[model samples]
Target: MILTVISAWRSLLAVAGLSLTVEGLYYLIRYLKRFRERRPPQVLFFPAPVTCVRPLLLSSPGHCNCSRSHRESALSCLTRLLLSARRSLDVCVFTISSVELSSSVLAVHGRGVRVRVITDSDYMALAGSQVGAFRRAGIEVRHDQDANYMHHKFAVIDGLILITGSLNWSAQGIFGNKENVIIIKSTDVVKEFIEEFERLWNEYDPSNYSFSPKS
Candidate 1:
């Protein structure tokens, strides 16, 4: 009788242990699932030392049979870079008249990415300029109000890639005139450009604009 009681107690204890183990595992799995759901998805960018240059010299008009070759054009390269922004896009340029580039900016903005544009105040009012369109689209745009030109032709994409050079985001700059664009993925270089962009963005804020009294 005593032996039977001991065996029964052991069996109960063993069953309780198994139940606790199963419960622990169930809660562990729940915790892991919730943690994964809370974490943001990781995005991998191209490794550093990745650089691209544009305004690839085009073959003589008749000699170039394939229009697809123009995909390497500076405009196309810039547009592709702009479209690659998953988090943010900072554009600081003297002027923006290229419809393709503007469209890319708008597209990224529509994707819920933060888009900020800084351009020359004077040029923003000029005809055929896309700065106005950017504003109408509800994207934040800032421009230098002083007499000096806000002559910057650089864009920091996702704070990872830096696109800069003599190439203006304009039809003439990309297609007609000789121009150059450099796309770099260096962390150090991109950090500097990001700082500059933030500084200009703050300096050009409407709240910081000053008006001189008329004499």
Candidate 2:
């Protein structure tokens, strides 16, 4: 009888342990789900201002053959700025024909960064335009639908840094022309650009697009 009693107790203990294990696992899974749901979106932070200028003038004396070190070109500066984005990149440009800059944008998008492009509808279909490639990669792109052109050239990185100026984000703008790019880290300036981007983004929404003649 005692042996049977002990056997019964052992069976009960094993079942109890398994029940406890299963219950623990269930709670763990529930907690994980809740944590994931409650987690906030990630954002990259910048404490101080950072500025990058483009088409750095040669530091060599008399702009001569003096082998003095020079700052990065506009293309390199812009590419680096794009690559530095961690959370979001909002590009509001007149056109994008620079292969290198487009590649950098694609790289960031591939890495899970939220990217949005707003460009002139006409230019988007031009030869060598990367807008189609962007759409194929599942990036959201918007364009002005009106007769007037969307001639803005700027980008906001992580809602913190603002990149703007005469740079067109094209090979011609970066290398061929006397272009300038100013990267500003001031939040006030960034805020203005962000507002403009949001306004244009909403205005250019496909749903709101109208090619009909305006009264």
Error of 1 at 36 (Å): 30
Cα lDDT tens digits, model 2, 93-186, are 9999877688888888988999999999888889989999999999999999866889999999999888887767776666567665667765
lDDT of candidate 1 over 1-215, digit per residue (tens): 99999999999999999999999999999989776544442222221121222222221223334434443444555666788899999999999987767888888898899999999988888888998788899999999988899888998889988888777777677656666677777676789989999899888889887776646
Span of ten consecutive residues with least summed lDDT in model 2? 43-52
**Pairs that clash in candidate 2:** none
**By lDDT, who's the top model here?**
2
Could you tell me how far off, in angstroms, the CA of residue 157 lies in candidate 2 after the best superposition?
0.5
- lDDT for model 1, please: 0.77
* Cα-lDDT of candidate 2: 0.78
